[model samples]
Target: MVGVSSARDRISLRGIRVTAHHGVFDFEREQGQEFVIDVEARLDLAPAASGDELAATVHYGELAQEVADAVRNDPVDLIETVAERIAAVVLAHEAVEETTVTVHKPQAPIAVPFDDVAVTIVRGRA
Candidate 1:
């Protein structure tokens, strides 16, 4: 684990879009849908930064892909669940000290016109 020396460093990614089939309705799984994910992580990486190693910090590219993969690969009932799951996934990285995740659904089948529906969650180490 990284020491307290390198505290409160953060990595953030915004507006990462992924096509997914996530909804409570059965037809949603059959027809599919689209989602946008935003992610941020706080990591302690003084050890890795001082040592100059790729292993020292969380890879944002890998994280973006992982978010996309998770959204596409899994079908769930709600965006809230997706956000929670993503928070857990990001915090699982050893370098990460805390994580925040947001899932957005723009094309929700609502009669009224609105920008989007979103869920945001924050998680950290025990």
Candidate 2:
């Protein structure tokens, strides 16, 4: 199998929202909030492009569900952990040579008014 490179093709899923309990605060763990996930999988797309077959590429719908399940079912204290978990899930696919996962915590309990806080992680076969 080929490894990932800067110019590799990518399949991405963005703005996937899920409600999960993930924070350092007690209120955040108890009350749960919306978490947005974005994923980008990099790999050689020549086969899929020429074949025009679903099996030739990563199934994005299933990948999205996996990411959502990881966010909803697992309770972690940090968004960094969430991002790591998402990256693992995305890299599990055989066709995915590499993946970058971003976990967005929009409603985090911050004293200052901010738009959002997020963590991004990249993982794959080295």
Candidate 3:
């Protein structure tokens, strides 16, 4: 097996778009909107690299589906909660040592004119 020295060596998935009901307001919840998600998983890659096998490392395609499912299937009131949930799901993979999840709410119910609203969280093994 190969070892990973730093979290910098990771598998990253970005701009996963999903329509879901998540917000603090009833209107926002009732009228689901688009959400963007980004995920980075840190794990050992030596085994996969040495063996030249897909099983040795994280399967990012499947991981992306899992993240999208988490966003679509679960409903929450805050983007923070969404980010946490995504992190938890990514961390659940046995190979993952640490993960960073970012949930973007472009259509947030803020009165001010802003480009975007997002929450990012990082979680790692204990």
Candidate 4:
């Protein structure tokens, strides 16, 4: 079925834009830039779907706030680290079995012209 959701479903939140200080260059760190994040969380949707209960699933509103806090609080030199941090936050939720995170540095300090620079990482429970 095209619209049917299975037990194993993915909830994705993309284009989470925020300004944070993170980069290898000193100037880049000092002058904060907008960072975009995309996150996908895979989990069992059966409970939430069947029960129609808020407690049965992860609250995306809380997740977004937490993700924003995760990016804003920590000052790291690499986007890879930021991605990892985000994955950690997603995995922190009990319902999430796995998570994929992408951190984009649109205003990256590069001499040559470029659209964007981003780092992606996947993490799951062990």
The numbered model that scores best in TM-score is 3
User: Of 1 and 3, which scores higher on lDDT?
Assistant: 3
lDDT tens readout by residue for model 3, 30-105: 8899999999999877777888999988899999998999999868899899898899899889999999899999
lDDT of each: 0.84, 0.89, 0.89, 0.90
Whose TM-score is higher: candidate 1's or candidate 4's?
4
Error of 2 at 21 (Å): 0.6
TM-score of 3: 0.93
> How many clashing residue pairs appear in each of the predictions shown?
0, 0, 0, 0
Worst 10 contiguous positions by lDDT, candidate 1: 1-10
User: Which regions of candidate 4 are displaced past 4 Å?
Assistant: 1-8
Candidate 2 — which pairs collide? none
TM-scores of the candidates in the order shown:
0.86, 0.92, 0.93, 0.92
For candidate 4, write residues 2-33 as lDDT tens digits.
45544359889999998999889888788888
Rate residue 110 of model 2 by lDDT. Answer: 88
What's the distance in Å from true for residue 111, model 3?
1.0
Model 2: lDDT of residue 57: 88
lDDT of 3 at 52: 93
Candidate 1 residues lying further than 4 Å off, grouped into runs, are 1-7
Positional deviation of residue 32's Cα in model 2 after best superposition, in angstroms: 0.1
Q: Which 10 consecutive residues of model 2 have the lowest summed lDDT? A: 1-10
Q: In model 3, what are the clashing residue pairs, if there are any? A: none
